[model samples]
Structures are given as C-alpha cells and as structure tokens.
Target chain A: MKLSKYNLGVIILILIASQAILAFLLFLGQPYFQLQGNSFFALLLLFFILELAALLIYEKINTARIKTSFGRFIKQIKLGNYESEESHIIQKYDFVNITDIQIELSELVGRIQADYNEQKRYIENVSHELMTPIAIIRGKLELLIQSEKITKSDFKLISQIMTKLDRLTRVNQSLVLLSKIDYNHYQDKATISFNDILDETLNLFEDQIRIDELVIRKDIKEDLRFNMNENLAYILIKNMIKNAVIHNIEKGYLRIKKLEDANGIQIINSGAVIHASTDQLFKRFQVEGGYQDSIGLGLSIISKICEVSGIKLTYTHHEGVHTVTIQF
Target chain B: MKILIVEDDLEILRTVLKYFDSFGYVLEKAKNYQDGLAKVNEFVYDCVILDLNLPDGDGIDLLAKIKQKNKSTGVIILSANSSIETKVAGLEIGADDYLTKPFHLSELNARVKSVVRRNKYEGDNAVRFNEIIIDTASQEVTVHSKKIKLTKKEYELLLYLVINKNRVLTKQSISEHIWGDFIDRTDSYDFIYSHLKNLRKKIMEKDGLDYIQTIYGIGYKFAEREIE
Candidate 1:
C-alpha cells in the first residue's frame, strides 16, 4: 500500500481543509439555530459528527489507493498505456515517453538501472585492478618461498594464501563479466548452433548431476541452428536447468526437452512446484535461500535476452511441477 | 621496468608495495599527483600506475602530463571514481586501463603484466608461466607434454584467465565472456565451480602444477611467482 508523495500530500491537505471549514461554519452558524446554551452544545456536537463523516469519506478514497512505483508518474504523463499487474514490472515502465508522467517514470527507472550499473562497474574495476598486483605479489612471494626454502608447513600456508588470492581473482572475473552484461553494450552477432549449445549447457551441469545423484532426461533434437549468440542460449538453458535443479525435491525428476510450439523452439524444464508471484518469476534473485552460490543474475540475464531478442520466456507451476519455457 | 605508483592511502600503498616487492622491478611511489608529476619529469618510466583520487590533486591531470611528456610510456590510471565520463576522459587523455579502488591486488598485478607485456613485448603469441603453455598463434593450450581436453567454454575461460592471468578475473567478467548478453538470472555460479574443478583436475592429472588459486569471497587467480 504505497502512495506517491504527491497523492499523500493532497489527501492530507484535503482532510485538513475540510475540518477547518466545517469547524468555522459550525462556530458561525450555531447561533442561527438559537436553541439557547444547552441546545447550542448539541448543535456543536452535530457539526463535529458532520466534519468527521466528511473526513472519513476523503480518507477512504485516498487510503484505498495503493499505486505502483510508476503509478502517479504514469498518470501524470498519461501515455495511455494500460497493463495488468500480473504481467510485468516492465509493463508499467516500458515507454520512450510522450507524456510527462511517462517521461518521469522512465527517467526514474533509468536512474535506478544506472545506479546499479555504476555500482556493479565500480566493484568490477576495483576487483580487477586489485587482481594483477595480488597475482604478482603471490607469484613473487611463491618464488621467494621456493628460493628461501621455507618450512613445509609454512609453504603449505603460503599455498593457502595463494588459494585465497585465486578466489578473489575468480570473484573479480565474475563481477567484471556481470557488470558488462548489465551495461549491454556488446551486441556482436554470431551464428549459434543450438544443438552444440545444448551440449555445452549439459557440460556445465554434468558435474552437478554427478554430485546430486540426479537424473537428466535429455530429449533434444540434433543440429538445431539459430541466428543468435550461442553463449546467451547456453545461459538461458543453464539458468532454466539451475532453477529446476535448485528448486526441486531431493533427487527429484529433472526433464530437459526441446519442442516446437506456436511460440517457437521451446526449452522446457520440469521440477517441483514453485510458490511465488508469477510476475517476478523470471526476475533476478527471485528464489530465496534456494541457493547462495548464485549472485542473482541468472534469470535476469535470461529475461534481458528475451527482451532484447524478442523471444518469449515464461514460467509456470501446476500439478506439483514447475516449468520454465523459452520460445526461440 | 621502471614504474610510478600514484596512490593516496598508505594501507593500499603499503599492501601493493609489499606485494610488488617480489617483482624486483624498479618501483617509484608517489602519495599525490604533484609528487607524481615531479617523478614523471625526473625519471623515464616504462609504465605508470596512476590512482584517480590523490591527496593533493586528481590523477587525471597527471595522466595528461605523463602522456604529453612521453606517449610511449604506458599509463594505467587507478580511481575510486568509475563514472562513464571519467572512464571516457581517462582513455581519451591516453590513460590505458582505468581501475577502481577496493580491488584485489592480484588483478592489479595481472593488468600491470599485460600493459607491460603489450608495451614491452611486440606481438608475443606465447604466454609461459610454468608447465602450462598458452600459444596465441596455434590456439593450442598444453601442459608439459600431454594434450588436455577442454570444452569451448572452458578453453575460452582459460584463455581469458591466462591473458588476464595475473589479475583477478571477476565471476561477472567470466560469465559475460563465456555467455555474453545471453545470461539467465536463474543460472547458478556453481556450474562455474564445477568447470574450474575439472580444469584443475585435468591439469593435475598431467603432472603439471596447479596455477589456479582461489581468493576467498572473490574469484580465482593464477598465483604469481615469489622471488625471495
């Protein structure tokens, strides 16, 4: 039940003005009744009741309204765009502006995105800049350790230190890559092979399957070609599979199949039931405590791809099964 | 190689200097951009690592000075400010790499190695650390004498790491490099762990030493050699 600052302010002003006007009229018009001292008190009571009723009516209209983030601004600009709340966060915010409200909402969302991107970029650069010197230090220290002929235990400790350094480098690598994806400046086109893409996606998940003792039912057709970037396809499939794997009953049934429907080539993964709002199902970091290793960018990246490429991606839960479908 | 490190914070400088001590390179330090300018005028450095926020002045101005004095000398600017405008300006004014603060020192070292390698070594296709070999021309990765099998992603991942080997390659960079605009938010990084594990296993099975080191709460790195 979030209301815009403007709407809240207007409601408060209306309530206050109504009360003040009603109080003034009751004070001025009380003598017209001329009921004398005791009756005058009764007249004042009636005026208070009337004021209260009026205030209640005003509160009802203002309090009943629970506007979305772009609600007020959307109305102010009047893009004449209407969308169901069950559909998308994007539904309300997607516009190039024509109305003032639309322009304001658009700018606000852009500012948010820019802020996140800037933070992401900052961390990435910092981590990357820190890497090489850490590496050189680790390298030089390792060289010195060998030459100095340090104790076996001390050498082992040095190895541990190096391991920590390695982790930083890896984290930095992921950060920089994530930041770049967030910016979305890279739009280089490539001939993507979906068949090979499935193979690679499987390659990514093979170890997880082995560790979990889970079975993957593969029903993919061979030599499927698409004029899209293969890397992104792999990301989409991988995230779908990840969702299935992470949000499943222990040793659950995981199905990976590609079939053509009216939408396009659909990659469907079936797992346990997903209980959450359907609208934000594809949003980044939707799953809570399902997996900590994920940096909450998988589904986000997938949704971004679907947005940029005009592909249809949907998630559904029914009959105790969660299905993520991507139509390409 | 002679290089100037322009930074304000003593902790960062101390840590960086302590880390680079083993590199055995001719290193000059400056606490502010004014001192940095003085050093640039006094000595001829092959490269300079400039930090943006200095105690006295912004490193950006010093960057232009260094570039004007000697275009051949490579200048990699460091900044706490990572605004797009700053990045564009830094690069436009002839600064090579712009790195933000609170970063892993290992990644810094890698960037330094690359800048130096590119500036010093002309078209060197081979990068040799120890037993492993990354040949740019042949596009072949070999450890000692055995041929290790690698997936397309794994190969690209390794090549990216090795090229930026000494530096910290953030997980985000790794995912983007491998997947690009096709990232799915549902995808977990655990998959990356598996690949890294496999890559390490393959290298170890061939009797080669493990160059890959994990930096806790960060990312992986190819640990630098220490010369005591």
Candidate 2:
C-alpha cells in the first residue's frame, strides 16, 4: 500500500473529526462517572491512531487497484484491441468517471477502422478495374500500329499516346505497391546479402552506366548482410541504384561503400543540384529536375520500405554530390 | 499451335483474340471459370493463357487440372495482382509463366511462343527469319551460315523482334522486354536506337540484308522490304 499526498490529507481530516467526536464523548460522560481525564484521553488517542493507520492502508490499496485497471485499459487501446470481446476497457473500466471516456474512445476507434477498411477496398478495386481497360487499349493500339493504313502523322500520335499510357500504367502499379506496403502485405522476412543484391542491381543498369560513361566504385571490406523481406530489399536497393544512375550527369561518378562507423551502407553520386527541399523529394509525384521519365515515386517507395523495416534512412545533398545512407 | 484464353473480361478477351488472330493459331476462349474448366477437360491445348480472377473458381486449381490432363501443355497465369507472393505461388504450382495485367500483347505473344517452344518434345530450337537463324538453346545467331557475335541486350532485342516480326514494335515494349518494367526511363529509346544501329552494322558486316525498318516517329519493324 502506498500513500500519496492527497490520501495523506484525507487521513489527517478523518483523524481530526474522530478526535473531536471522542473529546465530546468524554466531556458528555464527565457527569456520569468520576474518571481520570489523562488516562481516558490517552486511551482515546491510542484508538484514534489505530483507526487512522487502517484508513491509510485501505486508501492506498484502493488507489493502486484503480491505477492498474487504468493502465490495462491504456495498453489495450494502444494495441488496437478495441473490438476484443473481453476488453479491459469494457470489463474493468466501468468506474463512474472513466466509463464515459472509454465509451467515446471505443466509438472513435470503430469509426476510424471502418473508414480505413473502406478506403483500402476502394483503392484495390480501382486499381484492379483500371487494369483491364488499360490492357485492352494497349492491345488495340498495338494492333492499330501494325495496320498499313496508319500514316506517318497517325503513327506519331499513337507513339505519344503509347508513352502516356505507359506512364499511367507505371503510376497505377506504384500506387498499388505503396498501398500494399502500407497494409503490411510483405511480412515475410529473410537474411539478405547486400553485396549480392548490389552486384545484381548494378549489372541490371550496366548498359545505362556505360552509355553515360559513369565511373563506378565500390569500397567494402566484407559482405554486408541484413534481415528483411527479400523482395522489398531487392526493390529498395534497385531503386537506390537506379536513381543514382538516372539522375546522374554525363561522366559523373557513383560510389557505393559500407559505412565506416555504422552497420549500414551509403551510396554517393554526382548529380545536378536540386533546389527543392529534401523533405519534398520523398513525397509522391515530387519530381525534381523535371526529368520526363521520372514518375517520382522512387524516393517514396524507398522511404516506405525503410519505415516498415525499422531501418534508419537519411538523404543529404551537398552542392552537386548526393548521398543516401541506410542504417540497419 | 493451339491456345486457350480464360478471362472474365469480355473486352480484354476480344482484344487478345483479335491480336492473336494474325498468328494463325487455333485460338479458343472461355469467359468464366466453368467454361474454362469444361474446355480444359475436353481439349489438350499447347498453351493456356489463364486469368487468375475467374468469376466462379480459382485459376490456380484450373492450372493444376490443365497440367494434370497433359504435362506438356504450358500454362501462363495472367493476373492484375503484381505481388511477388502471387507470382511465386503460381509458379510453384507448375505454371509455365506469369504476366501481370495491362501487359504488352507483343510481350505476351513472345512469351507464348517461347513457352510452346520450350515444351516441345522434339526440341526444334532454331528461330529462322530469312538468312538470320537464332539457336534459342545455345543463344547463338547465324546469318547466311556465318556466325555473328551479339551482346546480351542486342540478342534479346533481335529475338523479340524476330518473334513478333513485321509488327511495329514500340520503344516502350522493347525496353520493357529487355530491361524489364523496373528501369523506367525516357532515354531508353536512345539505348534502343544505339543498340539497333550496332545490330544493323553487325548484320551488314556479314553481307546480310538489313531487315529492321524504322517506322518514323513510332518504332521499328523487322520485315522484308516491299519494292517501291
């Protein structure tokens, strides 16, 4: 049992009231029998002390029980267990003052959950429904282009239309990927070797690297490995390497190395200096440099993967040099 | 070659059928799961282009049934869900290949041809277009009985072109075919141009006629040139 300041004050008040009642009783009994005042007051004082001690212990135990029940309610809320049949909030938090707040909180959580589920279903349905039409249009265009009736001007129009269609397809796919990550779809994890993935990604962009005459450098003494979903790790690394190559200038350099002081890796590249704040770059559709090919979801995807994987990610650009560091 | 496409979307099915009509294949269509299952039970096709989101049944089960009927028949699962898990699951159940929705018809055609070629028992692996012969098994290209070296990207480009020969292949399709849909870049067209140039120069070095025709403002077409 613990005594807080408030409990202490209440105990003092109770003791004073009891002492008053005892003094009055002694005063009233003065006429009934001849008694030693000192002895009688001493006996009364002893009884009063005992009663005060009992009250303090009772108050402390009561307060402790309330604190624990309240703590359990908070824990349940934090874990999103609002719909539990035997929830602490419903069963134990039925005290006079707290019951109102608990009821309101549960209602709020229910509404939010419903809204979230609806939004998720809508996103899924829209993306799925849009794909069939896009496929049909693309197929029709392909068939149209094969016809001999299409003139030079018509071919140009078809080409432009095809480019836009490709863009639309990419945007839809990226959005679906983002929502999937948001919903914890990729929960499977495994030990992934950074060295192996980096090698493969670099090879994938080998043609572009050579075409741009970009210099490649690697500084790693040992293979870097981390545990993550293998598919996400591949995408994360591939996106990083792709950004490095795509945004790089002619004859620029790209360097990938293990962090000297941390359990992570860093990718440094020479590229055009950006004017937009770094925070905006990680947002969807925030394309810097106005590159026509960029859909600008790369950074967002990288950030999303990092967020879900519990990895520390930092992006810094100094002058013409851009650096991205991922700390596991 | 014989093929069956099981898709619920009528418009998509019609489009696919029309595009494949030029190939002279014995094409069949089933608009729902019941029809698809019935057709699969009745006929042993060389390939089945299956859409996973059937109206009445799961496509994976149909894929199993198709393979059970004939082990040599190739099944390519088409789906709108591009998740890695779905791809892995389909492939694990003996699916020959998987393609996501909004796919390129040319890419689909190329995959269908490749799948059929791979499942063929007699092992006829050579892809011959005029004097240009591509041995798919060895990844070798020969023109007029003379060997010519080609880079990996160049070789894939040549094969994709030769497989969908005479069709105006878009730069986007070509890029996606070789680099995949991951490398999203506008300048990939330039890479295509440079690679095609090198390919043209290499083929001409062996005194082979240039069959690659550039459709201005669009893409390339590999066909026998019509005399003007």
Candidate 3:
C-alpha cells in the first residue's frame, strides 16, 4: 500500500511516541537510568535507525511509482487521448487513492469533447443552411438582370445589391473556413515548397501587380520548404500576396526574400502610411485604410493557419512600408 | 439537352428550374431520394445534378447507382459542403464535376453544358457564336476562320461568354468563373474589363464583328448587335 506524505508523517510520529512509552516503562521497571555504555539503549538506537531507513526506502519507491503514473496521465491528456478507458486509470492507480480524481478528470474531458463536437456541428449546419438562401437571392438577381424592361437606374440598384451579396458570400465562406481551422479540419501535413507556392500566388495576382505598376523582387538564393498542410500553405501565401498587392500604392515595390538567420520567408511591400495598431490589424473585422472591398478576414486567416501549423507570424508597418514574416 | 436536378430544397430547385427553363432543355427535378432513383431507372438524362445532402438517402450512393445504370451519363454533384475531402470523394465516385453551394446559375449552366458535351460519344467539340469559334478539344479560338492568339485568361473569358451567349453575365459570376473565388476584390472586375478588352481587340483584328455588348451598370453580353 502507498502512503501519502501526511499519513506517513503521522505513522512515524506514532511509532516514535510508542517507542518513548516503552522506554519509559523500562525506566519505571529499573532503579536508575544510564546512557553511557548501555547495551540495551544501544540496541534500541540500532533498531530505531533500521526502522527509519526502511521507512525512507519504502516512501522513495512509492513516490517514484506515483510520479511515473501521474506523468503518464498528464501526457495522455496533453496528447488529447481523452477517450482512453477510465477503468484502466482507476485500476492502475487504485492503491494511490488517485482513482477518484482520475474519474472526475475523465468525466470532465468527456463533457468537453461533447460540447466541442456540438459546437462544430452547429457551425457546419449554420453555414450549410445559409448557403441555399444566398444561392436563391443570387439566382433571382441574375434573372432580374436578364429582363429587357429594366432601366439603367434599376440596373444600377441591382449592381449595388449584387456587390453587397458578393460580400456576404465572401464573409460567410471565410467564417466557415475559420471555424474549420478552429476544429482542426486541416491536420494533414506534408513537405511544401514555399518558393513554388509563392511564385504561383504571384502569377495569380499578376494582373493586379501590373495594374498597380508594382515592381517585384525575389531575393531567395534557395527554395524554402516547410512541412504543413498544402491547402493551408496555398491559402496563407495567397492571402499574404493579395494583401500586399491590394494595399500597395501606385508604382510601389514588393520584395520577397528568405530570412537569413531563420527558416522562413519575409514579405515587404510599399503602401500608404497606416495609423492602426499592428495588433488591431491581425484581428477579425479590423479594416485599415477604409478599403471598401476588404472583408478584413485575410490577416486573421493567415494567423489562424500559422497558429495551427505551429509557425510564427509577425507583422510590422513603418513609414509606409509593411513587412510580414513567417517563421517555421 | 436533357438534365435532372435532385435536391431536397424546394426553393433552390424551383429557382434552378426557372433559370434553366429559358435554355429549352427537358429539365426534371426530384425532391427526395426515391423519386430521384426511380427517375434514373426510368429515363436516360444527358446529365444529372445530384445534391449530396438528400433528405432520404446519401448522394454518393445515388451517384454510384447512376453510374451503374449508364456509364455514359454525366453526373455533377451540387453540395453545400465545400471541403476538399468531399470534393475529392465525389470526383472519385464517377462524378463529372462538383460545384459548391451559393454558386452562380451562369456557372452552373456552363458546367451542365460542358459536362453534357463531354459525355457525348461523338459530340461536336467546337463552341461557336457567330463568326467566332472555339475548338474545345485544343483550347483554340478562331474568328472568321483566322486563328487568334490569346492568353490563358482571355481564352477562358471568351469561352465563358460564348457558352452563355446572349445572356447578361454578371461581373461577380464572371470573376468567380475565371478566378474560382480566391481573388476577392471588386477590383477584379477591372481585371475582367482588361481581359475582355484584349479579347475584343484580337477578335476585331481578325475582322470579326463586335458581338460583345456592355450592359451599363450590370455586366457584359455576347450577342448580335440590335439595329438601334
């Protein structure tokens, strides 16, 4: 049986008291007490030393066993292995009186998992339900635009409505994507070449780049490859490049280069001066510069993908220049 | 052309049916799984638009049944689930294409046409609108029998416009068609404008009539010029 520290201390105290009482009884039987060169007293002292050593050794072994089992429990929890059999935990640590706490923890984990699953399901359902209505509205508008009786003013109004509808679709899709990321839907990891994704993203926005008259520069001596979900890598890089292009000034410049001292890439773009705090920009619905078309979710998506992929992201703006770095 | 849409949502089904009514196709719809299965057994449609989230049955199973009934019939899975895994699964189960929910009708119409064309054993591969012709097999565009060199985006834009000929294609639909919802800027309409300009210029250089019409404040249309 394992003994807690307090219980062991109490038992040791009781043993000492009993030993003292026995010595007193011995003294009571004797005419006088002697300490020097007393064989009986020496025998008592040797017995006490052996008993203490045995107790210490027993406590040491008990503590080590408890430590190992507790460590395993914590590691299991950390790894999200909450579905492991609670009976196993109880049976393994029954002697240490931790079975009750283990049972309680397992119950809590079960409750949390159920709640998380429910929340994820709710998100998916809400998004799915919203899609049909959006689709209907868009289709009706398309039908309206095809009518010959509609005047120019009517078309203008319809265009305005269509713009807002497009924005709604984009916002909804982004939210769905964000929730998916939160639920760890993108857990697949593979080695992805950052340079290839970067080039492809640049090509996608080539028209915008040319329209803005932005000069592009690539300073990578070698390709930077990192392990992450390929989908997320594409999204992250696309959003980054899109941000750089859309927010850039006329005739501005964009520079992409690998970090010299770190295994990551940095993007620097010339843009108008910004007064918003960097922290505010990373948040959802925090639109800077009053760009009307900005849905304000790009940065958050990038940050979210980086967070799930275990990459470090940093953003800074100074004197009309913006720099975003991703460290893997 | 003959097509069937199997969807549980009545409003979406009605809207799709109404939109495709002008296309003059024999369009049919089923509100549940059993109705859809029976229809598949009864008649052969050129294409079947299947919604994965059916009230009565799984869409993937229905897709397999359709393929079993006719290997040549095209099936396009329309779903609200835009996850990559679902898309890959649908395609793996003999689906011709997969379109996510809240999609443009014009895009859907284009997909239906493209799928029907591909499913035919001896189909005409060229998509022609007046003097301009697009050879789908080679992705080549020729105006008045003179081939014109166009960029990738230009080629796609021309084909999208020609396939939905005489219809007012919205800027949003066109952008989504070419860019696939990744580029989310209103300024992308500007990219559309620039590409269309180049396409028009190239066709005009080949002495092709100017069939592209800009409906002010709405979008562009490819059709015959009305004698005004």
Superior by DockQ: candidate 1 or candidate 3: 3
Deviating ranges (above 4 Å) for candidate 1: A1-267, A270-273, A277-289, A295-313, A318-328, B53-61, B79-95, B98-102, B121-228
lDDT of 1 at A84: 28
lDDT of 2 by residue, B1-228 (tens): 999999999888988898889879999999998999899899889999999999899999999999999999999999987878889999999999999999988999999999999999997899999999999999999999999999998999999999988888888899999999998787788899999999999999998999999998778999999999
lDDT of 1 by residue, A1-328 (tens): 4445665676568657866786677668767854576766666667667766666666555454423434554563343222223323344443332246666666665555456556755776675457546545544553344243456566557656655654454455444545554455334457667766666766665545665667677676665555665555665666666666655555666776665554344434345454676776556556544554455555676677666555777867775576677676
Task: Using TM-score as the measure, name the better of candidate 1 and candidate 3.
Answer: 3
lDDT string for model 3 (A31-57, tens) is: 565544486687568867877777778
Q: Regarding TM-score, does 1 or 2 come out ahead?
A: 2
Predictions: Cα RMSD each: 15.0, 8.5, 8.2
How well is each residue in B64-131 modelled by candidate 3, as lDDT tens digits?
99999998899999999999999999999899999998998899999998998898999999999888
Clashes of 3: 0
> Which lDDT tens digits does candidate 2 get at residues A1-328?
5565666787899888988898888878977855687878787879887998788778767777767876776786665443444423344564333346757765665575566567768987988898888998998898899899988888889999998999999999999999888866777899999999999999999889989999999898799988999989999999999999999999999999999998899999999988888899999999998677899999999999999888999999988799999999
